[model samples]
Target chain A: MLLPSRFSRMLEVVSAMIMDLLGIPPQVLFGQLLIGLINGAFYALLSLGLAVIFGMMNVINFTHGAQYMLGAFVTWMLLAYLGIGYWAALVLAPIVVGLFGIVIERTMLKRLYHLDHLYGLLLTFGIALIVEGMFRYWYGVSGQRYAIPAELTGGYLLSFMFLPTYRAWVLVVSIVVCFGTWYAIERTRLGAYLRAATENPTLVRAFGINVPLMITLTYGFGVALAGIAGVLAAPIYQLTPLMGQNLIIVVFAVVVIGGMGSILGAIITGYALGLLEGLTKVFYPEAANIVIFVVMAVVLLIRPAGLFGREK
Target chain B: MPDAAGSATATAPAPAPGPRPVALAVQDLNAYYGDSHVLHGVDFSVHEGEVVTLLGRNGVGKTTTLRSIMGIVPRRAGSVRFQGDELIRLPSDHIARRGIAYCPEERGIFASLNVLENLLLPPVVRPGGMSLEQIYQLFPHLAERRRTQGTRLSGGEQQMLAIGRILRTGARFLLLDEPTEGLAPVIIDMIGKSIRTLKGLGFTMLLVEQNFRFAQTVADRHVVMEDGRVVDTIDNADLDRRMEDIKAYLGV
Candidate 1:
């Protein structure tokens, strides 16, 4: 949202200093940094959903990637068949996919509650494969383009780099969504119910809260967050059935590094790791893809519960 | 041992004068945890506007009885009539909405929530529940520590919070499991005073306790259980006469 003219002079000096220090061209450094932040936004959004689901439901949601893919596909479908724009699809996709998540939770997930955690994992994993397979069959493996909205189609030229309005919009929206969700779960009365239920569901139910219904709704909301990320990502990445599957493995690493079931941890780690990956891409291109996994391994060895997660 | 069942009608005092209607009645209550049978035909009743205690040794189904009444137990088969509503088939939340509240033995305070949040956690089902101001007035210490995380409070404060949580739920019937367990003597006295205050407010309570002495102070009747069945019922007024018998049943 920033005006390029007002910040260009300040950007000139800062860009010059960073370029000199890093011994790199100004465009390459700032371009990679902006790309890193955009990627970070997605990581933050996806991992936040994973953490919330795991926190409340005690289920490691392997279907999150598939859900993310569904969000993007739904958005594309809305645009292709119904002439819906990106803005409208952005609002509608999450709701559509969230309802889908509710169906999954009520029909399949609820039955596995009394069983072992492994059973839930296996069930969700199986569902993810089926969902991804079905989508791939319908859409084919080839990538489809989703045009950026007209309002956010252009870029702002700065002294350091050209910033896309859509990337800035994505970054701002996800951050707001992430923190807004955190506030809702951690500060509100309904959040109190959720936290209490997370601790002891039987006791919360005895207090007259319908916990099973809450679980269903919670799963829906978490999947809906992934839907938001997917819609935001549609214009940036090619819309492919395997898009969520590819990003989900990385998101899982982020969740682990941030700590399972820790909301703030997921967010902070997602962004930090994204920036770190961007830096790796700049300095050592060979390590860019594996940097996040290396961090996850280190975090696991040092703290199994995650950096922010409380020890049980 | 003296024959309690055979001599019950011969030695038992007549129902107390001006007996109120039964608030809760459990008949032929049977409960199981997985494959293990915990309660075998357990039966008890608490009259309205009275405090009753279930007294037994460890693992003797006192807690199980309370849980079964609350419908928190995994499998229970019995007729638990509350205000003429059959509760054995209702879910725990439904049972709670029917004005039954349970304060678990562990206090069930959330570590992530502050004291006020814990107190306000239970939804008020009826119209007459205590307000936050009234609950804070009852436990001034809780008011002082309102913003403190629930688990950070002392054992006594946590117990008070648990009780206060239910009090705000407007549920007239309370099932308190070992409220004074592991508390200091002073805290126990404070809890006893709170119980008396709750009773004065006309709240019916079914307390499960191993401490018979504490039960004697707050309860109108003590239903003694052994091997998951009620072995004897001692009125608080006649507790002194049957202290040795009650002690023998409690095995303490």
Candidate 2:
């Protein structure tokens, strides 16, 4: 978090600049922008996970939102039942979700590869429903409070607003995770195998790489990204079984607009769209939700493959 | 003509051999692609340092036989012994790691990876594999395009890159399928020269090809397959005598 007094002065200059240039109240503009950035952070994380899985396996994991929810719930459960705190849960929750994802890949998702991609989509959609339904059955629709850890409870006072520490942390960590995953996939030897497998799995196998295991792990890694997003979101959003239900559709939009095949595309699209949504809320509150979809439609008309997607 | 009902036929016509040192031996191999059985009890062998080519018409299961050996195609029943190691039960990767490598018919180069990256992607499978510099020296054009992605290279360059990529895996046994399928005659000669170079280096190879002129340039012996069975083996020394028979078997 920004250290109060000195940080407030710098923020004041920034907010003043934004206000002088845009003719809007600095407070309202900064607040909305910050909210948009936080939302973008989550969107980037979720869509990145989906893109990675799709890149390697060509499976659109419909269960990603549920997996994200599981991350939050798993965090809550660990804290409530096992007395495990945020620090430990941060490390454990993603691993738990990733392993669960691997299990899903082996028992359910792997069987769908020989058929059409539609089958994998349908199967993951089914799994998402099952997982969300099970959670709702047990927890009910009402949300529960997940307290911000003591270390991250408060916010730093800026000139125009208060910036919450946890939100800031989430933004930093999300950026790190997205870039880290990108680096691992694009720069490493194992990444070459993954990319090659994505292109021609049969040939990769002939080259002596274990393509199946790599696919399984790619799916798992993608889910783990969702898990991390959920953990970061738990304290920010109410811990409810229905948390992931609505968010997934927006994430799908993010993926489609970004290019499901391009890692960097997804991250940038997520943030840019979020900012546009935020700006729309300030200018025309009624159109806030629809602006992203509008842009997506325009992009599709102009470039059917998406901003970064290659021709099939 | 492959004699029907003859299960195990040795067409080696060895000069002095009881059982010459075998580098790769396939016995009664059967394979399937979904419900269609491609190879029906196929048998072939490559002794140490031998450049044995499988020549036949299209869809005769010569490619299937190479794939089956590498475990890319599922072998229903067979014994594929590579350097005395049973390979039927192993996966393609395991088979590849055990001193054997494949240069597929289509030259499976990853479009996204640069030439150097593709060269380095497969692990130095053992100690004797060629180094990046050695591969570059062999295919100097690839050296100029080391930073270029695999897809952008021309057809001949891609073929050269594909062949050079496997040479570094330290695999002693190389399975080359149609290495000169669509190349110009000059390029074909270069490939033939490389094959001869590899042969002189003592690498055991099983080549699947249709170009008799090209195959004759690199192979020590040519095994002709008809309808998924080895019909006859012609020694290179006997090529002039058996030209008509080889043509009749190949039906070219």
Cα-based lDDT for every prediction: 0.90, 0.86
- Candidate 1 structure quality by residue, lDDT tens digits, B1-252: 122112222222234579799999999999999999999999889998788999999999999999999999989997999988899999999999999999999999999999989998999899988888777767778989999999999999999999988988889999999999999999998788778777766779999999988998888899999989998999899999998898788776
Q: lDDT of candidate 1 vs native?
A: 0.90
lDDT, candidate 2, A1-312, per-residue tens: 446677767877888887889888987877788888888999999999999999888899999999999999999999989999998999999999999999999999999998999999999999999999999999988977788899987778766877888888998999999898888878888788878888888887877888889988889889999999999999989789879987888999989998877899989988888888888878788998888888889989998889989867
After superposition, candidate 2 runs with Cα above 4 Å error: A1-21, B1-19
Top-lDDT candidate index: 1
Question: What residue pairs are clashing in model 2?
Answer: B129-B170
Candidate 1 local lDDT, A1-312, one digit each (tens): 455675777878887898789888889977887888888999999999999999998898899999999999999999999999888998999999999999999999999988888888898899999999998898899989999989998988766788889999999998999999999999999999999899999999999999999999999999999999999989889789999989999999999999999999999988888888888889998999999999899989999988998888
The 10-residue segment of model 2 chain A with minimum total lDDT is A1-10
lDDT accuracy of residue A207 in candidate 1: 90
Residue range B1-252, candidate 2, lDDT tens digits: 121112222222233346559888899998888898888788888888788999999999999999889888854578899889899988888888887889999998898899988888776678967767767767778999988999899889999999999988888889999999999999997787677766666678899999998888788899889887887888888887999998888786
Q: Give the deviation of candidate 1 from the true structure as CA RMSD.
A: 5.8
Worst 10 residues of 2 chain B by lDDT: B1-10
